[model samples]
Target: MRDLPARLRELLLETGYTLDGVRERLGTVAATALAREETTPALRATRDGDPLGTLIRLWWLGAPVEAPDWLPVDPLVEAGLLAVQDGLVSAKVHLQPWETGGYVVSDRKVRPGDPALREDHVVGAGGASANLAQLVSRRPAGRVLDLGTGCGVQVLHLAERAREIVATDVNRRALRMARLSWALSGIDGVDARQGSLFEPVEGERFDLVVSNPPFVISPRGRFTYRESGFEADGFCHDLVRLAPRFLSQGGTCQLLANWLHVEGEDWRDRVGGWLAGTGCDGWVVQRDVQDPAEYAELWLRDAAEQGTPRYRELYDDWLGWFEAMKVTGIGFGWITLHDSGSLDPVVRVEELGQRVELPVGGYVDEVLASVGVAHRLSDEELLGARLVLAEGVVEERTGPPGAEDPSRIVLRQTRGLCRTARVGTVEAALAGVCDGDYPLGPLLAAIAELTDQDAVDLRVRAPEALRPLIAEGFFHISTA
Candidate 1:
C-alpha cells in the first residue's frame, strides 16, 4: 500500500482536493469500504502524484510544507520511534506531565494505513483531548493507567514518567490505531489492553490514572468516540466511584468529564457524593454549565458535522432526554482524586471564563500544597493566623471629573501574589501606616483624630475591612 502521505499528495495534486475535501471523501470511503487497507491501496495506485513526493517527505519530517525546520527532528518521531499522529493527534501529547519527573504523551487520533490521507472522522485528538491533556498532573508516578485510550494519547504521556503504563479501550479499531501511533512515535513499555474502564486491569494498581473518557451525556451510545453507553451520566459517576479501587497509596486520578445538572440537586454536592467513602481525596472543578437548549444544539451540530442524519430529530431527542430526567443544564469539568484519605480534601468551584491557557501542573501543585497546609492547621489556627501585609502596596483613589469627592478607592499590591483590595479612606490610610509595630488601637485612635471621626467608630469599621485583606494575603501583620 502507498504511504498515507503519498496518497494525500496524489489526491491534492491530481484532483485539487483540499484537506477537508479529502477527509470528506475518505469518510465516505470508510463508510462503504469495510476494510480501509484494501480500499486505500486501490485508491493510491490509481491516483496520480502531482505534488506527491514532497508532501510525503514533509509529513515524515513533521514539518509543514510551508515552514522551515528550526528544531531537530522530535526524538520520538525520528526513531519510527514514537506515534506518528495526525496534526490534531499530536495536540494530545502536550497535555499533562505525571509530575516534574513524569511526562504523558499519546496518539489518540491516528490510523495505521495512510498517515497523510486519514480522515478526521474518528474524533481522535481535538479540543477536548488537548484540554484534558493539558490538565493532567505532571507529578511522577510508579504506575500510570490511560483509560479509554482512543488512540493512546494519554498512554504516551504516562509512558514518559511512569515505571509501568497500561492503556485500555473498548474499540478494537481505536486500539489498532493506538499501536500504530506508538510504533511511529518510537514509544515503548506501554501495555495495550482491550476492555472498558478498569475491567482489563482488575488487580492492578497505579500511582496515577488519567483519562479523557467519552463523557458526553447522550441518551444513546451513538458515537463511540464521544458518547458513553451508560445511561443518565452513569459513566462519569461510575468512573468517579471506581477510580479509588485501582489507585495506589497516595496515588491520584485526574479525569475530564461531563455531568447532568438536575433540577433538584446541587450539582457540586451531587458530584462530591460520588466520591464519598471511597477512601480518597477529591478535587472537582466545574468549568462550564450549559443549559439544555444550548447543550442539545452544540451536540447536534457536532453530530450533523459528523454526517449523522435527522439533525432535527436528534436535537429533539436530546431535549426530551434532558426534560424527562429534569436536567436543566450540563456541567463540564475536571475531577482529580487522591487515594490517600486526607481529612479535608480540596474542593473548589470557580468560574473560569471562556477558554484560557491554564498551567494544569501548576494548579495541581497549588491544590496539593493547599491540602497539605489545611491538614496541618486547625480551623481555629487558620482563623487566628497573623499574616504580615505583603510589601509595596499601593492605593489609588479615583473621582468623577468635576466632583470633589473620590468615587472609588482601589488598593493594589505590587509584590507576592499580586491581589487588589478596595477600601474606604480610613482603611486605606490605616493600611498605608501599618508598620507591624503599631497596635490596632493606637492606629485607629490616630486615624480618628485626623479624620474627625469617633475613635470607637473608627476601631469598629477598620478591623472589618482590614481583617479580610490580612487573611487573603493582601495585608500581613508583623509577628514582632
Candidate 2:
C-alpha cells in the first residue's frame, strides 16, 4: 500500500476524476444518491465504458467493472486496492472524495445486501465526520493534533494549515487507514500513532487539536469507531477534562461530544463541571437534545441493526443502564476550548438549534476572543470602548395591522453564529446606530437627550445591558 496512494492519484489524474468531474458525469441525482451510500442511481448513470466511469462504479458502488484503456488499473491490483476475479475487477477499499479535492480511504460500508463489517471497521467521511470537518477551525497554527483521526479526514485539512501534524487513534486499523488516506491524497509527513486518547502524545502540547471522537454513550458498545467502551459519557468527560493540558497558550481544541442530561440537574452546570480546574476558556454550544429513547434509537439505526431481537436487546440494555444512572436525556454538540493563562478563566454555554452557515470554525475564534475581552473589562472601561453593529445585522419589527410601532423588535445577524436578539426600543436604537463613531458613554448620553430620559440613568445601565451583546457577537469592539 506504500505506492498505492501515488498510483491511485496518478490514475485519477489520468482519468480526470474529481468531485466536480464525477458530479458532471453522474448528474446531481445520482451524485446525491451515491453520497447517501446508495449505488443504484450511480450504477444506472455510469453504464458507459469510460475509464473514470468504470472506476467510480467500481469503488463507490461496490460493483465490479472491466478495466478501461487509460486508467492503468494494474497499480490498483498490485496495491491491493482492487481484486480481479472472474474477469471483473472489484475495489477492496472505498476511496470517497471529500469537498477539499482529495479522496478519503477507508473500509467499505456494509450495505444492506453486503456482508457485515468487522467490529473494528473504520468508516469514511460519515455525517459526524463531515459535521466536525465543516466546523473545524481554519485559523493557521504552528502544530496541530488530530485526536482519534479515523481515516484521517480532519488530518487532511489540518495538514494544509499547520506546519506539522500528529494523528492518533486507539484502533491500529484506523491508524493504518489514515496513513493510506494521507498517501492517496499525496499528503505526507503526518505522524500516525496508535494509542488511546492522549497517551501517544504525552507531555506534548499543540497549537491546535481537533477530534470527532468515539462519543456514543451506550451500554458497553461493541464498535470501535463510535463506541468508547466506557461508562455513559465517561469518554467525553475525560477528554474535555484533560484537553487543556494538551493545548498551548491561546491554542484551541475543537471536538464533538455528548453529555448526560441528568434529571433534576442543570445541563450547563453538569457540563460546566468538566471545565473546573482546566483554566482554559471553554464554550459548549449544544445544538440538539434528545430523550433517552430517541438517542438510543438513533444510534441503533446508525449501527444498521434495527428491527431485530438483537437490536431490541441492545436497546433495552441501554434503557436500563440510563435508568439506573438517573439519566433522563442527552445533549450533543461541539465543545471548544482556548488555553488561557488566567486565574479565573471564563466558560460560556449556550444552545443554538437553528441552522447556521457552514464552516462554523471561525465562530470558535470569535468566542474565545470575546470571552477574553468581555470578562476582563470593568464597567467604566467597557463604557469607554467604541463598538459597531456586526455586519449583516438588520432589525425586524412585527405587530398587528396599523400599529404605530411594531410590538416586537428583533435583531437578526446573518454572519458567524447567525443569532437573533430580541430587544427593547432603547437597546434597538443603540445597537442600530453604533457605527464605531463614538464611545458608549457619548452615544447613550445623546440617546437619553433625544428620548427625554435622564442621561445619567442610561449610562448607569449601559454596561449590564450591552455586555452580553458584545460577548455573544451581537456587536464588535471597533479597532477602526
Per-candidate Cα RMSD to the true structure, in Å, reads: 10.6, 2.0
Kindly list the per-residue Cα lDDT of model 2 for residues 1-480, writing each as its tens digit.
456577778877677677777888899898788667687888888888777788778777778887665555677788677888877788888887777777888887666545555788888887888889878778889889999999999977777789999999998988888888888777899988899999999999999899999999988868899999988898999999998889988888889999999988999998888876788888888999999999999887776767655778888999999999899899999998888777778888889998887788756677678776787788898889998888888889999999887899998988778888888777898877899999988888888988899988888887887778788788888888
Q: Write the per-residue lDDT of candidate 1 for residues 11-40, one digit (tens) a residue.
A: 334542333433443455542452332344
Task: List ranges where model 1 is wrong by over 4 Å.
Answer: 1-121, 305-309, 354-357, 371-376, 383-480
Q: Candidate 2 — which pairs collide?
A: none
Q: What TM-score, computed on C-alpha atoms, does each candidate reach?
A: 0.63, 0.95
Candidate 2 Cα lDDT to native = 0.84
The parts of candidate 2 lying over 4 Å away from their true place are: 67-75, 307-309, 401-405
Clashes of each: 28, 0
How big is the positional error of residue 44 in model 2, measured in Å on the Cα after superposition?
0.6
TM-score for predicted model 1 compared with the true structure: 0.63
TM-score for predicted model 2 compared with the true structure: 0.95
Q: What is the lDDT of every predicted structure here?
A: 0.62, 0.84
